[model samples]
Target: MRLVVFDVDGTLVDSQADILASMVDAFAAVGLDAPARQDILGIVGLSLPVAMEALVADADHARMVEAYKGSYAKLRLSKGASSSPLYPGARAALDRLQAQDDILLGVATGKSKRGLDGLIEAHGLNGMFVTRQVADFHPSKPHPSMLRAALEESGVETADAVMIGDTSFDARMAHAAGMPFLGVGWGYHAPSQLDGARAILNDFSELDDALNALWTD
Candidate 1:
């Protein structure tokens, strides 16, 4: 069986604007300045704590985490999760993949299970994926554990699976898991940053071709 694992935030959806806005709101709630979008984007795919470590040099970790959660909750509770939306052709691409009897769909993302599930439910993608490995279950990106779990959960070997994402972290993680990486160009991370990827897909239209080629190999 061929299992295709995907990253959520940047690979299938564009949530940067909402995410950045929420980060700014979090910083304001804590009386701190928000980091630049470049900095935040650079740390895409990392776990929350890891992202914080990359962006904040002097802030107390625990305090900042609490503040961020508090502020994000305040905004998220009232905001109705308007940030994450499927990218153009994303649904079509996924449906095409699913139409193949040999292909199995799964998610390996840095998002929390609640967040991931919420997005999937909101977008009516409940049954699109057979398995999910969220941040709540494993260490952040650049670590092989998450991918490993996804492979295990989907009952597929790393060699038979492909990882699709939008950051260097995802490429490196796929490499670590001994799987092929397909980098998405329209994400927060630059395509150049994923130079080590098995292939870089410029958009959803290219995604089907990339997957077809990868599976054909």
Candidate 2:
């Protein structure tokens, strides 16, 4: 079976507004100035502690992480998950891929298992992915541990797997794991930053075509 692994935030879902807002609140709660929006967006695919470290110097990393999680949860409760919507055509692409018996879906994300679980349930995507790798169980993006675990759990070869995401972190992780990477242009990082991607897709409509080409070629 061909394995298709996806990244969560900024890739499958556009959670920029909520992420940035919560980050701002997290920093504020800790009596610190928040990083710029662009700075926060640049680190979207990283685990919270690592991202927090980059955003705040010499602060209590664990406390910031907890504060960020609490702030994010509170924001979600108030604004609802509606603030983070699936990009146009995302569902269609997933549907088409899921219908193919040879294509097995998986997720390798920096989100916690709880966070990823909520997202899948919120989107009614239960049981769609055969493997779920989260930050809770592995090192952050670009470390290749998550992708490695995903491949091992799914029993899929690197040559038969492809990583789809929207950031350089994802591309780097895929490359490090010896998996082909396909990047989406609509996410956090710039298309230019996706240097190692086999192809940079402009829209979800192009996903299948790109995947097909990757597998065939």
Candidate 3:
């Protein structure tokens, strides 16, 4: 069987607006300034601490980090939570992949279990994914633990797997596991940022072609 592991945040859903808004609110709550939208979105694939580190240069970044978490959690739990929406054609692509008997679908993301669970369940996408590797269960991005765990859970070999995401981090993880990496253009990472990816697509329609070309060998 062919295993297709996807990144949830950018590849499936366009949560950049909500993510940036929440970060801005979090910074405001702590009396600190938030990074610009472009800057924040640039670090989308990294874990919270890593991303924050990239934004703050001061020594008191730890404290700011805590405050940011407080604001982010609160916002996610309340009003700003449901602002994220799936990218156009994401559902159709997933549905098409699900109908194939030889293909398996799963998720590998930096989002915490609670957050990912809420989003997946809310969109009724739980059944479409067989395995999930989230931040709560694994180390941050660039680590192979999450990908390894997801593959283990899905009973798939590294050779049979591919990672579909929008960030270089996702491509890096796939590289660590000797898996093919496909980058998306309509997501958080700019196309130029995904230089190491095996293939890059501007829209969902190109996905099947890329996958077929990769696996046909």
Candidate 4:
């Protein structure tokens, strides 16, 4: 089976507003200056601790992570369900891919299992993924641990899998895992930052054709 692994944050869902707001709350809670939005988005796909480290520098990593999670959760509760909306055409692309008999969908994301689960439920994406790898179980992006686990779980070879994400971390992770990378332009990082992607998708409408091109032998 051919496997398609997706990154969650900036790839599938446009959670940038909530992410940035929660990050500001997290830093403020710890009496630290919030990092710039660009800087925060730069570390989008890494594990929270690593991302926090890059943003906060000398702060208590554990505390910052907790604060961030709490602040984010509070924001979600207070702001209603509109915090993260799927990018345009994301659901359509997923539906199209899911209709294919030979394709097995999976998720390799920096989000915790609970976070991913909430997203899936909130977005009505139940049963769309055959494999799910999250930050709770593996190293952050560019490490290949999550990708490797997803491939093994889905019984797909690296050569038969493609990593779809918006960050350089995602491209590097796919490279390390020996899988092709497809970058989405609407996500956190710039298209230029997604080095090694077979092609950077400029529009979600182009996703089906891009996936076909990458998955073709």
**Candidate with best TM-score:** 2
lDDT of 1 by residue, 1-217 (tens): 9999999888898878767876776566557898988987788788877887888776666666666556555544565546577898999999998999988999888877777877787777878998888887788898999888878788888778999999989999998988999998889888999857878887788877787788788
Candidate 2 structure quality by residue, lDDT tens digits, 1-217: 8999999888888999889988887787778988888999999999999999888778888888888788777766666558578888988888999999898999998888877887787788999999999999888888999989988999999999999999999999998998999999999999999978889988898998898899889
Taking all chains together, each candidate's TM-score versus the true structure is 0.92, 0.97, 0.91, 0.96
Go through the candidates in order and give the clash count of each: 0, 0, 0, 0
Model 3 lDDT per residue over 127-178, tens place = 8988888877777887888889878888888888899999888888888877
Backbone clash total, candidate 2: 0
Q: Candidate 4 residues 157-215, lDDT tens each?
A: 88889999999999999999989999988898999989988998887799888877776
136 Cα displacement, candidate 2 (Å): 0.6
What shift in Å separates residue 204 of candidate 3 from its native position after superposition? 0.9
**Pairs with steric clashes in candidate 3:** none
List ranges where model 2 is wrong by over 4 Å. none
Poorest stretch of ten by lDDT in candidate 2: 75-84
The residue ranges of model 1 lying beyond 4 angstroms of the native Cα positions read 70-81
Candidate 2 differs from the real structure by a C-alpha RMSD in angstroms, to one decimal, of: 1.0
Comparing 2 with 3 on TM-score, the higher-scoring candidate is 2
Distance from true location, Cα of 199 in model 4, Å? 0.6
